[model samples]
Target: MYPPATRAAALALLRRGSSLNATSVALGVSRATLRGWVRNAGAYSPRVAARATCPRDRELDAGAYAHLLGLYLGDGCLSEHRKSVFALRIACDETYATLLDECVESMRAVMPNSVSRNPAPGCVHVTSYSKHWPCLFPQHGPGRKHERPIVLEPWQRESSSAIPSASSAACSTPTAAG
Candidate 1:
């Protein structure tokens, strides 16, 4: 184990505008270790890899997944963070409290992870952290979502099509408007 002095020195170099690669090379420490140190500076929280839950593994909640997908396709983005973790953020109007709650519910129903609502100036960012978000949402990419070509995977196509339509609903008695 390296001494605390070594860790402090490495962090000091990093604070002094040294890149992770350069700091590792100069301090004789591995980049992964440096990342771990940086990730857990104040407190050491072990990284617990989430379980593998995908369409292939089991049946996805079609209704909730479809709802989440719609919201995602509208104003959502998946950002990549350190250690291959991804944060899914969906923007909803701050005035719509039900929408923010629905967003959080859909995310939890889909991934059953920790979902948070971060309030912005005029909107709220409903975010969830997971490693499998990219796998679930194939449309995520760099730059604006509209700028990228959104071609769904075969599984996504099936999921979207699985959404129940209201065509089957038939009323025995017609209303005055009908």
Candidate 2:
């Protein structure tokens, strides 16, 4: 369990758009503990969801982004490490090595059967590294620089889908393909 002060700091960091991993690092707490706090803490009340509107001009230069996207999407066989790096590229021009590590761990958790070729206890990590996470995400990278992606409430997804709306345009920034 987190102390009240740590919990408060974690929530504040999260509200300020810090990634969960960022919040964990800032608070010096384990990611799992921080996640538990986020899930179970009633201290932070949910606020009205806000739609972030980008200015009319291209939020990201299309030509440059297309080139970057092509680099990653072209070969169609990007390694997990490369995909994570590519996502970091779009995310504030720097990769969050910590988050990338976590993503790899998660991929390990879901390793496919064929990759179970190894009967060792820690074999999943290797499998995850080789597997491509195509289609796991519709969007490419993490959220904007210095900020984390907002955790959409269940209602938000339904609401967003009901209308094939302009919000789609907001993601004009280049993102990873897989």
Candidate 3:
């Protein structure tokens, strides 16, 4: 099975008006495979279909949603280990235990089914078996998120705007105030 990230990238490329052949070449996937992915995108995740139908309706709180989006842009990625299970891995340096805790907290807030595990010394895996991961974190593209343009959907923008102050406060470094 193709990685959810790769499939997401293919969908992104196609959404930008790229031809099927071009998307296949850019993603290094077979034309038939790309076609199959396009056909199956909606069926792969019911949440994706629901989101497309109603963008304003969301399950995550504004603050946690914004935090999850930022985390996905920075260090998170989606991978499919099996035909039915997808894992969202966020790389975290071991020294930043607090950041890892925040990631776990945000993930739990967004997707309670997610479990945070330390796969390596400097990485944390917030893994789940949900097929909707790609739909939720669609920033996967040709290169690093920094190197590519990350555009938030209208609903995401509205949701993010709702909690900018909270997001900023949560993202700030803690200081010892005497």
Give the clashing residue pairs of candidate 3, or none.
none
Better of 1 and 3 by TM-score: 1
**Predicted structure 1: lDDT:** 0.68
Ranking by lDDT, best first?
Answer: 1, 3, 2
* Tens-digit per-residue lDDT, 1-178, candidate 1: 8999999998777645467778899999998897777666531223211232233355678877877887777767788855667888877877767767877887888876778888765677788877678878878776777677788788777887888630111112211110
TM-score of 1: 0.62
lDDT of each residue in 1-178, candidate 3, tens digit only: 8899998988777655466777777889987787677667643432333322222234566787788777665566666657745577666655666877777787766654546565664344554545556666666544555656778888778767887543322222211110
Who is ahead in TM-score, 2 or 3? 3
lDDT of 3 at 60: 61
Candidate 1: clashing pairs of residues: none
TM-score of each: 0.62, 0.25, 0.54
Alpha-carbon error at 136 in model 3, in Å?
1.2
What would you estimate as the lDDT of candidate 2?
0.35
TM-score, candidate number 2: 0.25
Worst 10 residues of 2 by lDDT: 48-57
